[model samples]
Target: MDPHNRRRHPTTTRLPYSLGCHACRRMKVKVLYPRPHYRHSLIGSRQCDEEKPQCVRCTKGGRMCPGYRDANQVVFRSVNTEFIPEAQNSHLRKTSKSGGLLIESISSTPLLTQPTERWEAKAIGHFLYNYSLAPTKDSPGYLGFLSDLLSKEPSNRQLKSGVLAAGYASLANITGLSHLKRSAEKHYGETLQSISMALTDPAEASSDTSLTAIILLQMYEVCYLREMWQSFHNDHSQAISDITLVPQDPHDKGLVELHRLRGNSPSRTAAADGILHIIHGRLHFNSVGGLHPSRIDAELAFEGLNISSSQDELWCIMREMSESCGKIRAIMSDPRRNMPESAIIQSFDRIFAAYLHLLRWEATQSLTRSYQSYKMFSREENDTHQETFPYKYHLFKHIAHGAMWIGFWCTTIYALQTLTRTSSLLDVQLLSRGWHQWDFNKRLRDAIGEICACVPYMMGDVDQLGLPMVGKEGKAIGSFFLLRGLYVAICVEELTDLQSSYILKTLLRIAHVRGIKLALRPRSRWFAQHGIAT
Candidate 1:
C-alpha cells in the first residue's frame, strides 16, 4: 500500500493535502475555507503580488480581501493526548503505551471541599480583619463587638448574619459592586427574620448578640439608604424599645443613655447638672437685665481671655460664646414683651464681642500645631493608619477640624441671625451704623469659606493627599459636619444662586461617595426642588 493510504483506515477519513493559507486552518471550515481575497502563495498556484489595499489576484477577481493575521500570533489547540513538558515528565515511571497514556495516570484527585459553615467562617474572618477596629473610641463599636460574638462557641446566628450583612454592605460601598450589595440585602432580610424569631424566647431576646444584631441592622439600613432615596422611617425607635428589655450590661446602659439623649430626654442627673442650670441662668439673666443683660458672667469671662491662653482656656471661651448664643435666642423668642432697640443693640454688642474673641483665639493658635495634634490623635486612635495606610490620618484630621469649624460656624450664624432679627425690629438707619462696622457679609463669607475648605478633607481628597481610611465613626462625623455646612450655606441670603448650587452639588457628591444616608435625603430633596438629578 502507499504510505498515505496505509495511515488511513475505514474508521478514519483523510483530506487531500493542499498548500492553503493559515487562515483556512484557523477558520476550520471547508466551504470558502481559503477565502477568495486571502493572500496565499501556494506551491502550485501562480505567484501573485501581495499589494496593500487589495492583493493583485483579489483585485482581478473582484473579491474583497479580509486582512491577514499577524506573523507572531499564537494560537492554542486542545488535545486529549498526554504531552507533559520534559521538565515535569521525568518523575513518571516508564510503562506500556496504553498504561502510560491512560487518563487515570495523570488525573488529579478530587479535593475534599470544606463545609458551608467553614466557608462562612472564612468570609466572616476576612470581614473582621478589615473592620474590627473601624469604630472610634466614642462610638458603640458594634463591628468590633460583632467580631467577638462571632468567635463564641455555638455562634450567635442572628448576630453573625447581621454582621455579615453590614460587612457586605460596607464592602459594597467601598468596592461599588452590585453583587455585594445584593448579598448584603439578602443577609439583612435573613437577620431581621432571625431576630424576630429570637425575640419570642426571652433569654435569646435579651442577649448581647441580639442587641448587637439590632445595631448592625441599623447600620445595614444606613448603607441601603445611602444608595437610594427613601422616607425617613424611625427604625431605631423599635430597637430602642426592645433594648429596654435587655439585661443592663455596660454596653446596654450606654445604648439606653444614647437612646434617651436622642429622644430629647436627658438623664435626670445630666438635666440637673447641665441643661437645667444653663436654662436657669438664662432665665435669671433675662428677668434682671430686661431682655438684654448689661453683664453676663460667661460673656465677661470670654472677654477677659488673653491671646497667650491654652486650648483648655480657648475651649472655655467657646463654651461661654455658646451660652451667650442661647441667651440671645431666648431673648429673641420671648413672647412676654417686645425687645427695645437699645436692648437689642446691647445684646448684639455682647454676642459680637464673644464672636470676635473666638476669632482672636483661633488666630492665636498655630495651624501646624493643630494639624500635628490632629494627626497624632488620629494615629493613636485608628490602627488602619499605622504603616500600610498613612493617608487615613488626613481623613481623621479633617474630622477633627470639622469639630472646630462647626463651633466657629455656629457662633457666626448665631451672631448673624440675631443681628438680622434685631435690625428688622429697629430703624434701618439706626442699626446700619453699628452693623457697617462689623462687616457681617464678610464674616458670613469667611465662615462659609472655612466650611467649604473642609469639603476636600472630608471627601478624602486634597491635592496629593492620601486616600481616606474612613470607618463608621469617620463617615458619621464627616457627614454631620457637611450636612450642617450645607444647611448653613443654603440659608445664607448673601450667596448667589450659582454659589449656592455649587456648594449643594459638592455636598451631594461627598454624601453619595461616602454613603452618608443622613446627608442624602436633604440633598436629594434640594436637588429635586432645583431640577437637578440626584
Candidate 2:
C-alpha cells in the first residue's frame, strides 16, 4: 500500500462492501485486498496484503473480507481494569440542567474563600459593637444615625467595607495585635478601592451610603493613625463641599441636623427649614449691647440655677455655648468675611459674657458640692480597691468633671480668641479695667488644674494624687473625654512650657494606649503652632 495514495474518508464512511476475511471479521473492519506481487511474497502464503476491501490473494483464496470501522468511533482506555463504583464517582459528578453528565473535582474549591468571609464578619461585628461608644456628649446623634444606616438591608458595600476597616483599626488599638493591625490595613485598602469605584457612578457617589462611608473612613484615620489625621481633615472639608451639590433626600435629614448642631455649615435647604431654621434665624446676626442674644437668654434661662439643676438642662446650655464658640471661631478665621467694628465689639462682648456665664454657673453651691463629691469619690478609690469599687464609677465621676471643665475651657478660649482676633483698644481696656477683678492667668491655671485632676482618676492612681508622678491608665479612657482634656490643655495659656510639654506628651501616651487618633490632629497642630517641644 502506498501511504500518499490512501484517500482520506468521511468519518461516517467504511470500506467498500467486500467479503469478510477472518482477521477483518474479528476486528469488525473491511479487509484490504490488493494484487499480490509475486516477487515480494511467497507464492504459497495465505496472508493477503490486507490494504483494502480485499487483497487479490484473499480473492484467490476465496476468503470473505470484513468492513472497516468508521473514523469517528472512539475507544477510551482505563489505567486499571478494576473500576471505581458509580456511587463513589457520583461525588465528582456535576449535574447539568439537561440531565447530562459533567464532572468537577473537589480540589477546585478555593482554600481561603470561607476564611475571608469569616474575617470580614469579625471586623464588621467589632464595628457594630463599639461604634456607639465613639461619639461625645456634643454629638450624641452620631452613633444613632450610623446605627440606622447599618440596620437597612442589601447593605451598602462601600459603607460596610469602610466600617470593617475602622472596626479592624479599632481592634488593632484595643489589643495592639499585629495581625489585627494588618487586617485593618487590608480592609482600609479594600474600602478605598470600593469608594473609588463608587465615585465613578455619580448616583452612588452622592448616595447617603457613600457619605457615611467617607465619614467612617475619616473616623478610622482619626482613631488609629496620627500622621493621617491632617489628610482626613482635608478630605472631610472637601466632602462637605461635595455633599452640598448632591441631591437632598429625606433620610439625609439626620445628617443635616448633626452638621448644623455641630456648628459645621449646613446645607442651605436644611438651614432654611424646620427647627434648624428657628435656631439659625434666632442666632444669626442678632446681638445687643456687645452680647449675643442667645447667650444672654441662655444665662437668663439658668438664673437661680444650683447644683440641683437638671443635668439635661446644664448639658443643653453647655452644648449651645460650645456650638456658639465653634461658630465664632469659624467666622473669625474666614478671610473673606469683613466685620464692622460694632459687630466685632459685640462678638467680643458676647464671648466675654458667655465665659462669665459659665463661671457663674460653676460657682453655684450645687456645682461646687458636686465637684467636691466627685473628688472625694475619686480619692477614696485606689488600684487596690478595684475589687470593691469598679473603675466605671470612677470613670463616670471623671467624665462629669471633665464635662464641666470642657464647658468652661471652651468658653474661656472663645473669649480669648475673640480678643486676639480683634486686638482692639476697647477689648484691651475692657480687660485692663479689671471688670470684677478677673485674672485671666489665674482662670487658665484653674482650668488646667481641673483637667489635670482627671488624669489620676483615669489612671487608677488616686493614691498618688498629691505626688508628682505621671501615671498611665490600666484600661482604655473614653476618647471623648481624653480629646476634650487635650483641647483644654493645648489652648490654655497658664501652663509653663515644661508643664505644657509634659501634659501633651502624657495625653498623647494615654491616647495611644486607648487607640485614640482623633485627638492627635489638634494636639499636633497645637505643638507645631506654638513651637512647643515634645
Cα RMSD, each candidate: 22.7, 24.0
Q: What TM-score does candidate 1 reach?
A: 0.45
Residue pairs whose backbone atoms clash in candidate 1: none
Give me the displacement of residue 386 in model 2, in angstroms.
27
Error of model 1, residue 193, in angstroms: 8.6
Report the C-alpha lDDT of model 2 over 122-235, residue by residue, as the tens digit. Answer: 666656654443333332222435555666734677777788788778768767778878877877788788878876776666455665676667557756664443443456
Give the least accurate 10-residue stretch of model 2, judged by summed lDDT.
Answer: 284-293
Instruction: Give me the runs in candidate 2 sitting further than 4 Å from their true place.
Output: 1-130, 134-156, 173-179, 192-214, 226-345, 360-408, 416-424, 427-438, 456-477, 497-502, 522-534
lDDT of 1 by residue, 1-534 (tens): 788767532221222432223333344423122324653533224433334455444555567755444322322121212223321343444456765652324435222333444434443654555433333432222144444455672456787788778767756665677876787788889998998897787656645566566666755665566433332234434333332221212333333333333333333321122222222222222222111222233322222211223434545554565566666667777798677777776776776677678677667766642543123223444566433212222332435344445545545654565555555655564356556524666676656655555555555454224444445223443454455555555555566554565677775664456554445544544554454543
Clashes of each: 0, 17
| TM-score of each model, paired residue for residue | 0.45, 0.47
Candidate 2 is scored at a TM of 0.47
